[model samples]
Target chain A: MSIPITESITVIDTTLRDGLQIEDRVVPTALKVEIARALVDAGFRHLEIGSFVNPKKVPQMADTAELYRELGSLEDEGVTLYSLVFNAKGAQRAVDAGALQVKLVISASEGHSRSNSDSSIAQAGDRLLAAIQVLKANNVAFEVGTAVSFICPIDGPTPPQNLVSILEPLVAEGAAGVGVADTIGNANPRMVRTGTKAVQQAFPDMPITVHLHDTYNFGIANVVTTLEMGITRFDATLGGLGGCPFAPGAAGNIGSDDLIHLLHREGYSTGIDTEKLAGIRPTLTRAIGHPLSSKLSTIPAVPEPAPIGRASR
Target chain B: MSIPITESITVIDTTLRDGLQIEDRVVPTALKVEIARALVDAGFRHLEIGSFVNPKKVPQMADTAELYRELGSLEDEGVTLYSLVFNAKGAQRAVDAGALQVKLVISASEGHSRSNSDSSIAQAGDRLLAAIQVLKANNVAFEVGTAVSFICPIDGPTPPQNLVSILEPLVAEGAAGVGVADTIGNANPRMVRTGTKAVQQAFPDMPITVHLHDTYNFGIANVVTTLEMGITRFDATLGGLGGCPFAPGAAGNIGSDDLIHLLHREGYSTGIDTEKLAGIRPTLTRAIGHPLSSKLSTIPAVPEPAPIGRASR
Candidate 1:
């Protein structure tokens, strides 16, 4: 029996944040703002522009404050710009930059937490408490996202309960939403469904986004699985750029252009234009100084939607 | 609510026929046999060794007869060797070469038939009538597979009724099983599900297999969808090699190594040893004179089975 899919989904393009975090080339701030502008023009209402992390540790994201200063006016145009904040310092940085929305990220696994944040999961949660307080004090909206929420490279699989337990604090503290991530791109569809279901069961009313990577080519499939589960939010990157420096064998996030193509072809309305996103590939490729890894970027043309067959009819 | 998956699936390795068909280099006959033997050793009971096409048109398959002769003894080991035959002459070649099981292929769409077989679908059917007769006369087991059953490069999407109409004659003639293929690799899961559902309704008793390419990275996802429909048979190529030369933008078939990994991870027993398959990648890479296209071929490690989460527990 064919299951009915959810009617609509919200996609958050994370090209400027997660996508450029580990690049060898440091993209100019103007280029980052330009890509963000083009993404907004192409119908992306939610975007993760950058992270408020130490500039010396991650030079590519050093211009996050400047980017906010340049494009902060787009908030009036119904765009929601999100930046990653791990500690109170990062939260203060977001407030100083006039960020309206911030994502508080903590690793769900101990190994990833240690390497990614230099602390254990509990310690990372403790660190986030300060950021959560700052966001509350400044009246800035925030969502809590747990990285490596499905499979951790250093640790094996993050248990679904572990994801639930890790988000309990943030959910209790009035989180605007919750997101689960397959940080290393090693998760399968079953894992995604299992983990996201746990989070959904725990926070029934909170919006849940599933962050996926294309390392194993299961990104879109996981999206399909999660969509079937009625989870509506997804985070993707342009041209499938970016991998975690700390997560071994991690690949790029699922490409936004490719993801939207799959969504539209499946009869879901994304309100996003595939041709316009595809048109941005050369610019993305030029900025990255390498060809994109997305199927749409490498292929000659985006396949036209075929006629629906008898069974669907 | 999570649905229970089918207990297992049958994976037919088609590396020799579909994997090496479009490569720039002509792999040696010995290497071809070696790969076939390795596939069987890796627990593949069904293998498509080669096609009985003209030497000038497809030089890579010129050694089909020789390969069958070399590996024919494996039948005693319970391994079935399949070769593609399009006409009466190819059927005779299969019999002469000692092929106990053969696959009779016809393109479901008009454009593919004209370019691939130099005939219309009707003419190709008329041509296959002789091959089917020959197979029946010889008492050789045969299965009919429709190429481009989902989407055709030239004709666009082949409708479900078109697939059913093309396979009607063969199904009526006592074909052992039927297979629907995404020849150009541009098919999404909805197309696969829609097309396969129509075929299933038309011939409920005929066993069905799905042949997919990873051009758009939907291969495994389509596999997941088809499996949910209780269709257990699949065709894959080792190292994800091969494409349809007549179909523009067609990529390699779903990688056998990757397919087995996904199946096992999703709790479906394919009886395939992924480690053994991974070990054979180097030899395949050397034979093709290029790196393989499968994700597992390039990835450093096969992700280990992680602890099952709360829902399953």
Candidate 2:
């Protein structure tokens, strides 16, 4: 909202993890690797493939460790695979998989924290602190992510102070990056700008990533605000694949295809190949067993994206 | 992209005209009247009720004259009603219906002009010129609008110069405003900013309204860019309820309900009541005989929109 965005951004494709976690059908680990590779071919260097939570609770992501190990070679190609770890057990799984990086997520609001995981923010932090031990023990670099960083479905509008409070403890534990999520996709641009500013102010040294859901179609606006504030890391699902099972009307992260198209059209290079995006979209539709929600996914046959006014970095 | 948006915006709801034009089943006039009234109650000062196109060509809008007459009293409340007119015959219909204002539209690109109206842009411009004589003869104020203002479905990206060339003649005829449309919704934010800026610079004394479709989900991002660049007039449908029959994969305009929510959330008021928006939405869903596409419509029950940091102009 303040500055014009000209810098190249790191778009984290979270299709395998956040996208599939809410689905009743569990995507097999091989198919997950295929989608992951398709994304890497499309030029995504950072990816969030799965979370190491309870397999029983999120059966779709039960193969997190396996998927992480399978895609481990991507690190050689300069691609960083990410997983969401909530506790020491999840952290142990990360270590077992030889993970290079992991995103440790805790809900910012008590209501979401309780619903997403049966614990309050304090209790989740203690679990995360323990998880850090396991991650540090194995030398895995971890980024801390907060769910409902902008607005909580259960509680209400989250004050920016609450986000800072929750992340203060985690960031102090040598977290490499701080992640803010609009878990319900209900945040206004102003709220996103203010909250993101607060997080940047609190931990100016930490790289900030904004994870967005398009439940209310405000995801792109939040993307605009976050980019304007000079923060560039964004987490999105390919073809908008994920939704929250706990939040009644949550939508998937904003579509990576759509976001990349916007970025490329605005002269920012994501290094992701837009033509290759079409190849991976059908796999998602066929595997997810439902029609996709991304705008590009619904089109009959869009010409491979036209990069208009591409800005030279 | 250059200015901070701090002004009140006029959101013109085109649900009755463009929203219903492509539907096979023509909506009864009574229902159209009911929807118009509901929009006015929601604080929409400008409403596009219908277009005076040939009944056989676009049967859905055959009732344009009737709807205009039925809602004539709203003009007393400072509500300016708009209808799309293509030729002198359409302009005659508007004058006969006691119209105070009308938006005369022509395609900006030759390919779209051929497909949409079976004529080239120059030929269609001549027809609009004829329409202007009839409008001026009756002293009815008019605004000139161009379809495919940013990109044509058949042609590639529209150069900004093309918009100015097509609009120059019409603007010279004492037109009150200029309307630029991304008729196919393929416009990215940069295209929108460049095109809109071209129009603003060419017609420095005139009001500019942008009509957008969401075929690519860039509508909201374009909305952000256009608003940031200080264009205050927008056109949208009630539930993302419009599409083009000639355009193979066109989606509806960005939803009025969704746009109002975004505007309100950003501290800008559209003079539209968000609470009343929900009540009128079901009427549209029922009339359209299909599920609506607005993000707000898809959600089971969105808490009435909250205007965070509402700005007072």
Name the top TM-score candidate: 1
Instruction: Show model 1 residue runs off by greater than 4 Å.
Output: A1-6, A306-313, B1-6, B302-313
Query: Which pairs in model 2 have colliding backbones?
Result: A242-A252
**Candidate 1 per-residue C-alpha lDDT over A16-52 given as tens digits, one digit per residue, 9 for 90 to 100:** 9999999999999988988989998889999899999
lDDT for every model? Answer: 0.87, 0.85
What DockQ does each prediction reach against the true complex? 0.43, 0.35
DockQ value of candidate 1: 0.43
What TM-score goes with each of the models?
0.95, 0.92
Candidate 1 lDDT by residue in tens digits, B43-143: 89999999998989999999999998899999999988899999999999999898897998899888789899889999999878899899889998889
Tens digit of lDDT per residue, candidate 2, span A1-75? 112545688899999988999987888888888989988987899888888888887899889888867898999
Fnat score for model 2: 0.39
Alpha-carbon RMSD, each predicted model:
3.0, 4.2
Q: Which candidate ranks first by lDDT, i.e. highest?
A: 1
Q: Which candidate is the best by DockQ?
A: 1
